[model samples]
Target: MGRAGRKTVLFDEDKPHNRVTQESHGFITQDGVKPSDFKKRARTDVQKYPSVSIKEKRVEIIEKSGGVFRIQTKEGKELYGSM
Candidate 1:
């Protein structure tokens, strides 16, 4: 996503792992990689981008109206933007 181009992007902080460990499938190169390994790699790639920022907080509420969206984060941040 490009900065100041898109209307909104919300990232709900989640571990993304349903269980402690899992097996990979269908990928030819890394067929049976560990779940943690994938997570770490993905996080690293995201961190490499200058436009991507990471946040850790549950989104309490999100509402949209009149081409604008408002999000209330659990970290006590209220944000408004256009779409």
Candidate 2:
């Protein structure tokens, strides 16, 4: 989507849930990779595109109305997306 100039917003909470438990596995070529490492790589790749934006804020609510998806962040910011 980024290569095609489509807007992409990735919301990551950066929680350490995996660190407190076990290493993440089951994906092809990504086995044994730490959760933080995986996210870092993904974010780095996505950042190559100017149209893609990553937010560290958590989403508080999501609703669909008038053919658009509305997302409210914990910071009280509202964002809209169309399918």
On TM-score, the candidate that comes out on top is: 2
lDDT of 1 at 81: 70
Which pairs of residues have clashing backbones in candidate 1? none
Q: Candidates' TM-scores? A: 0.62, 0.85
1-83, model 2: which lDDT tens digit per residue? 77789998988777756766455688789888887787788888999999999888889999999999999999999999986
Cα deviation at 82, candidate 1, in Å, is: 3.9
Candidate 2 Cα outliers beyond 4 Å, as residue runs? none
Predicted structure 2, TM vs. truth:
0.85
Worst 10 residues of 1 by lDDT: 1-10
lDDT of 1 at 13: 77
